[model samples]
Target chain A: MKNRYDIVVVGAGPGGSMAAKVAAMGGLDVLLVEKRQEIGSPIRCAEGVSKKGLKKFLPQIKKEWISCEVEGARIYSPDGTMVEMAEEMAGSEVGYVLERKIFDRDLATLSGDAGADVYAKTNVTDLVLKDGVVKGVKGKHLGRSFEVECNLVIGADGTESKIGRMGGIDTTLKPIDIESGVEYIMTDIEVNDLCNFYLGNDIAPGGYAWMFPKGDNMANIGLAVLGKYLIKKNVKRPIDYLNKFVKEHYKDGKIVSVVFGGIPVSRPIKTISNGIMLVGDAARFTDPITGGGILKAMESGIMAGETAIDAIEAEDFSENELKKYEDKWRPTIGMKNERNYLIKEFFINLSDEKLNDLARSINEVKIKEMSVTGLIAMLIEKNPKTLENLSEILLKYL
Target chain B: MIYVDRYKCGYCGTCVAVCPEAAIDLLETFIDINDNMCKACDICVKICPIGALVDEE
Candidate 1:
């Protein structure tokens, strides 16, 4: 560890690593820190990302990083009515299940090769704020404490984003907008090439269940319940929800690995502050509908990296200069997030009867492709009552 | 009182972010919840996916 650097990126996840890589490649001295001893171990994701989403950033998908390549998706309603769609129309976690342990580490290695000082087992305890402007970070590396000054601080910290809070950025998520989730890496069950999504308030209130195959006969089975749903009787921790899912579905399956996490299912929060920027889950950039952040994390990282260089060249690290980072993401990913949030809100509130009806209607069409516009038209023709309770966007058309 | 069941804990740090008081801290493999700052909100308890965080009996 150095005493100073041009920029300091907290967390070694994909977002931070990409930011550090881009900044270092641009000739800026960068420091990347990860609290964990290993770059990626204790996997937190369902490990699924759209094929096109990953392709936008990486040159090519490495074979080892992929566990499975799904061709489409299967969405089942409470009554078991199934609506199938090709991968092109699948939301976020459809196309591929990645080995994040390898993928996250490789990204950090790329940043290191680009001249960023990447350090694992490094923890950022606090931000060095000078008059409410983030000046640097104070933390420990291998049992040694140090304070390093920097012109810019990029917080790529995930769901539990203390870095953003320490830098005076509010990253609070309401119970309705936060999902408590768990997953089990199960084997000894027949798996298919398509990802499966199950919906019903009875199965997982305020959320949904999914099974993403990971090759062979293994699959990742998981479900998340929004915080708002937890307050209801008999619904406590997400483990209970996962247990219900396993009992009913994967009862004969073997549990090899158990994982727990919380996904922020909210629209984008403020991502930039004075001399500070947040990327990935820290910025609440995860897709509101799918709770997927891998693609958006990399997107924000690239923008943050470019914005950092722009600020450095202008000799201005003020919020005014850093605003470009958020501005860059707003029109692109931000709009989609807001729209998805509304759709998620509506979907979660729907009755099981409605979900089953919609599923049957969509399945009946037997379409080759699933497009939003086409689905809207089909829904209006087949199930007009369901559209009556839609949010602002659809109501305008009605 | 030990509120954290270490055996069940995965330490993903979800409790730390959702803490309204900012009372919880994730330290490597373990998570520390500062009692002084905690208000027994049970938010972390309900949200803990693995049932690692339990409400004090």
Candidate 2:
């Protein structure tokens, strides 16, 4: 309720709340604002987060936020050939399908517990500046617009973040880099507890369909395909394709809910600016291929919070100093995004027959039988001639 | 024209919440309608809170 604070975080999703929590824990005066009356209401995500990525922050696992623990993953070829790996060998980050509402609220609660002031239903309309630097934000609360000041402002406002855009960052995504997604949560279904991924152009182009089991007889079934893929296929919306799949495949189950959203399939923005920083989906910190963002959002949130505290304590919140946060997250999450970009490009450009052939080739590998290294070896074995193409495509990864 | 307003639709399970045959689902942050499974029942239209959905005919 004070007019000014040491730090002000805009948006109360995972990123913003995390930043606020860290800043508060650092003993700085912090305020977290959310446009919605509830922190996680009107959710816009796939709701999957890796256990590996989360352990570094919270350390202790909270049970209430998790819907189901995913032990391993199953990859289905276009022809329905299954490639699965054991739980222990699938790397360190096998994930959990979360109840995002509880997860988000818990994060906000942590911020409050850490001594940050939290405000909900507060819509920030514009930024308040002093000497050309972002000093505070002006927005409406309960029908009256008010302004508040702070040493730093953080934007975790989501993919179509007004704060990031208003701050003069381009934040524009190409059609190919935008994914249209649709999903349904259904009950009375029998499926393996592990998450299942389906790949084929008919189901989703330049993307894949996923069925994440939340509990017995219930699952979140969804697909995310690039905008370019939809346009090229002449589909008006991604939901049409998803509905068709549901009808053909899930005949007996009853749908309990439906979700439609867009995921930015691009790398994080290069510069979120000197005094202003963007985190989470607002910064396009989603995985370009998988369309998963929880880990990256939390990761970026931690970095942003640390940097904001540093800047505030230093008494110099300049864009140059804040760029360090961007630098740290961009290399890990950003580089993976670049790889996804290449893989997406290759997958999207392939003809239907090529896709089928690719599936068959992958079937030969039985990638589940191989480790990450073994999978690559099998791929190399089958397509000895593709080494050059793979090299060219994956050059940046090296 | 029949259309869905993306911003208003929150995948709340209300439309799917009232469907007789289990035709609706609350996926992630939004809703997905199975046109094949839908009988064009006026149930969804009546239950939708934000008028995000419309009956074409």
List, residue by residue over A1-398, the lDDT tens digit for candidate 2: 88988888888888998999998988899989887778897666667766777787779778988888786677776777676754555443367888888999999999999999999888787888767788788987766788888768888877556666557776655556677677788899877667788888787877788898888888888887665554343244456667777887787889887776667787556646657888887788887767888877887888899998888878888888887887787678777777766666666676666655655676644354423334444665677685556546565586
True contacts kept of each: 0.65, 0.03
Model 1, position A145, has a per-residue lDDT of: 95
- Interface root-mean-square deviation of model 1 in angstroms is 1.2
Runs of candidate 2 with Cα error greater than 4 angstroms are A88-93, A231-234, A364-378, A393-395, B1-57
Q: Which candidate number has the best lDDT?
A: 1
- lDDT score, candidate 1, position A269: 84
Error of 2 at A68 (Å): 1.0
| Candidate 1 TM-score over all chains jointly | 0.94
